[model samples]
Target: MPVSDLTAALADVRALLLAPDDLVRAVAAGRRRGVEPPAAERVEVRPVALRAGPHLQLVSRTGPVVSTVNAPLGERAAAAVDDLLAQPFGNFHVETSSQVLQLRVTKRGEAQVHRSATSRRAVQAGPQAHDRTKQRLVDPDDPLFRVLGAGGDKRRQVDAFVRQLAPLAPRALDAAAGRELRAVDLGCGNAYLTFAAHRWLAGRAGEDGAALRTVGVDVRPDVVERSERLAGEAGLAGLSFAVGSIVDADPFDGAAPDVVLALHACDTATDDALARAVRWGSPVVLAAPCCHRDVQRQIAGARAGDGLGGGRGGAGEPLVRHPILRERFADVLTDALRALVLQVLGYRVEVVEFVDSRHTPRNALLRAVRTGGPRPEHLAELDALRAQWGVEPVLARRLAPQLDAVRALA
Candidate 1:
């Protein structure tokens, strides 16, 4: 076991737990690094039926007593697994339909990994897996989906995306009440999620007998044309597509949007979208950022002498030294900065799962709802993080005016 392989092995364990269909059982046992496990450290994972739905039940056993917790099968389950990995657990055993994996951490904190094929029959003989049944938000046969070629796998993703926004729609609509609610979806490549957003909002508006308008913007003219044509054929009103970059798009015709969405916008394009949302003072913003090349490159180019490589002694150097870990950490750092900036601009921000990880790797969503003024503590936190990383997020630059006002308050 070497330092280089440890992170990859841990990442693989994470992937296995995230695979809702394959994960049968997993256990994290033993301890090391001179850190004690919380209460009962020996934890076992199994699929279980919960009142809400199917969940991955985590049972921590110590002698005759056991403490249990349940995490919904998806990104949340992956998060629970992460909490366990952060512990001093020295060994991990995972069983799936196709394989079994065992990872033991050596005294040096290096990982020794072993994996073997497991027959599906033997895997199935164990506890039954969670039921994969999920209620659909949008029917696959709907004219909107059929016309857009969003069926089967694509439809599943659409449903998941729609479900992600389902809870927030009521609140957004309540604020609009008697007025027409407007939404703008930026970087809407094929406009699948854009159309779905429109449908969801429109339906909710219809219940209250209110009006709803949704606009989809993309840089590609061809994709815009196809989306527009599909909307026409589907006879969906108050829904349209426009060709323009997120920064330059005037899809709302100068009117501020009630809801601003940017799903899977690449790199700095997401920053552009967020800047626009802040300038417009959009009440609600949902953005699922795709690539984090901006911050990733900055971290890669940082120097140890400047305290950019995770401080003077390079305490955080190992995380950024590895290409894969650096990329992943950059993603987290970028989103965290985005969330902080949103807070600085007077929005209560939440970074949560945009969709099940199975549908897409870029599942993290920044859901922001405007509350009031920025908190000095949050602004300080933002500054501390940027200073520590020796990186200026493109978003921080993009929203400089708004952030400056927040800073002046301090």
Candidate 2:
């Protein structure tokens, strides 16, 4: 992990410009230039082909928002990267058909290379610019897409949402064969993502070029009707929308869903959606929870009550002594409990920021994929935490019936 190795590792990354061997993804970030690029905390580089010729895209990122431009890949791309290394502010992460590297570059002209090489998931390196809201997955010309306009934010969200699904597709597909793969979007709202998922699925080719079945549910009747109209206009045959509550919505409609998704579903609604997904034992679950009021109220109540029952961290004494800190504490505790519950029920769970926090304060995505039973340690931890807190989450109550089976499975 010496910084001296960064120079050679970067040289190897530069070799990606040689073309015939190709590149996958590359990035140079941090404040190496002394002057930071406008709205760009870092820069990303990728080889792309345009009608004119092969080029490298220089994408500048300031938080979640990004601005990119194309330049000839030969000298320009090489020199740009060289300048970055010369001033090297942050880590350099590079992936190519031939190698995968993580170089921690310091301003002192030193680099710590953790992974200098790995031969895995090689790249075809498409010529055109890649988009999160891929036209292939969310057609702009489609009447529905035209009406929606698919702005940069929407496109980015679509891209981010689909990206998370890529790694689990194989397992999900294995569970879904012969029949079309099924997905259900709880709180489908205007169904922007419902359509995104459908278009995404349409582009997903299986060995049989199989079709996909998807449903979107929202409480608002008008939005459901509007989403349905859009689907009709877009000529998407298997996608549909319905009016229902995430709490009571039987989105599966008697069919077992391969994926259950909820984006920014508010408060306990997210818990409800996730609980239902777990009970169904769905292979994949994605939820971006909003409004931590439920847990916040519980925290306030605990402090107002006897000794804060001091959940898992309760023994740490008063973590929530102030209003602002109380709010943040509740948010973390809520998601932690959610993750532990999923782990207890035989699903691998990860809570991650789904987007740049600058885009929205509520940006966490609780993603889970069923991978068999839970570990005993996870169950014991969850049990002890619950006993200490002396309070239950909305999702915990809903999942109570399965608690015994969950522990037994573990």
- Best candidate, TM-score: 1
Per-residue CA lDDT of candidate 2, range 1-410, in tens?
A: 24466567667656664442356666664433244433344566776777788777778654346788777766776676566555534555565555556565444545556453443332355454354122222333446557556776676666666655544454465567667888899997777777877776655523335678889989999998888887888788889988888777776567778989888888888888999898788998889888889877876666655535654345534677778887887788788888888887888776767667766688788878786765556878777666555557777788887776666665
Report RMSD for candidate 1.
Answer: 15.8
Per-prediction TM-score to the true structure, in the order listed: 0.69, 0.66
Measured with C-alpha atoms, the lDDT of residue 316 in candidate 2 is 34
Candidate 1 lDDT score relative to the true structure: 0.78
Which segments of model 1 are wrong by more than 4 Å?
1-132, 309-313
Q: In model 2, where do residues sit more than 4 Å from their true spots?
A: 1-21, 26-144, 205-208, 307-318, 388-390, 408-410
Superposed Cα deviation of residue 326, candidate 2 (Å): 1.7
The 10-residue segment with the lowest total lDDT in model 2:
131-140
Clashing residue pairs in candidate 2, if any?
3-111, 49-127, 310-314
